[model samples]
Target: MKRFLYFLSLRTGTELIILTLLLNKISGFYGLLAILTGLHLSSLQLSMYVYSLFALALAGYLTPHLRRQSPIHVLGLAWFYVIDTVVNAVYTAAFAINWFLVIGQHHPTAVRFGHTILEPENVTSISIILMLWGLRIYFILVIMSYARSVLRQHVYSTSSSTGLYRRENPSDPDSGTSIENPFATNREDGKGWEGRLGRAMIALVRSYWLGVDEDDGWARGMGGKFRRSGEAPVTFGPMERERRRRSGTGPLPPPTSNPAGIPWATQGTK
Candidate 1:
């Protein structure tokens, strides 16, 4: 959906992880449907499992959207993802056991369950299921990777507007309580271990899993720009004001433009 995609664009690091999380949400919905149709369960048990999954999937979708817009929500979202991953893995294992060990051993041939037949021995069906499970496992890794990025951004931020996890409180009353540390050596300076590990994982995933080499060509040109200097207003304003104060002189009075477009200071002459 367009609205869903708008949230995804806000991610600064681990874009693949966000993408996979979205995809996983979609797959989870489908799995929920499959559970309803393909598997047999008691009315109470089925309803409980269905409701549980529905709630979890809803949380998964909402967390990313909330965290994307507000950095303060990232930590809570990370915990949600961690719990969701474990639950999903347990559900996967349960299904795998039912499909292969129990069903395959007993019903070598396809068994009719209502309108749809459960076929555990079908080569294509099994292969498809295995592939989906493998993708799910990889997505768990993606979720962890993104969580680390969120934490890294939360722990250190150079500017309120900059970074993945931007600080929410820009106008705190005690803003001067903490000393600022600016590291402009690299575009990703002060990313800490979480960031470095996330990047390495992303690179590895891109290379081996996605079959694409990371394009570091842009890094060479971008380095100088990031490392050059902070923006003029932020870097120079305080220093210039301090210099004026030290010299016992405030800002020059407004200049008045004459008819010929020449300007003169507004100071009165004795």
Candidate 2:
């Protein structure tokens, strides 16, 4: 599974985030430059740039948190990226319609290629638009994959640290334990607005946001998680069961409710 981008191989979410911000800032700079150069801008173009400014601010705030395994900030940034993708698409569609359909109809034909009279500017712009949109789709995938990695990493760390986890049998490999995103729309994270907003933002693409995809395993590495049952995954220091046994305690009990502040699972008393 290829976790990173195919060409650059950007492995971490932080790199993806920084790349996103840097590209957007460059875009913003170009927009401002156009304004300075006396290039007349349509209302739609101006609005699109304005929305990008908001995104830049939000992403900037969340960017620093990308380095940390903090779920709230990471999830916030992921949701922002997904929402911005949709919003940007709508703006792009409007711009494309204006450029290709309305404005192109008014333009004088400049180039003749075989049986068709094609404008060189249109051909070049069309090719560039297609390529940019394709790259945008790939960026969304990498960002989501990285977000999933961070969310799962936090969950695994919490489970190991608190010695509370959900498994059919305590001896089962940690790989069998659930690592669902608590902030996902479907998760019963009883705590207020964060879950609600997550649902609202991701409801349209719930499956994509929450479910596994190609290369997710590669993104969610086995440093402290998802090891085979035989490999004996260790979190923190000593095994929880081993410590309990040495202290003259019986095997640990199953988790009653979601421990480690995870609100996604609820197990019966065992």
Best by lDDT: 2
- Whole-model lDDT, model 1: 0.46
The regions of model 1 sitting more than 4 angstroms off are: 1-40, 43-54, 57-61, 101-126, 141-269
Q: Which lDDT values do the candidates have, in the order given? A: 0.46, 0.61
Could you give me the TM-score of model 1 versus the true structure?
0.38
Q: Per-residue lDDT for 1-270 in model 1, tens only?
A: 111124643244334554455565565455557665777655644554664656556566556554463332443354455666677666665665555555545654534432122443455665786797676565555544454444333323334323322222467753322212222224453277544543444343332222212332333223334332564222235865887778978677544555655335543443
Best by TM-score: 2
Alpha-carbon deviation at 13 in model 1, angstroms: 11
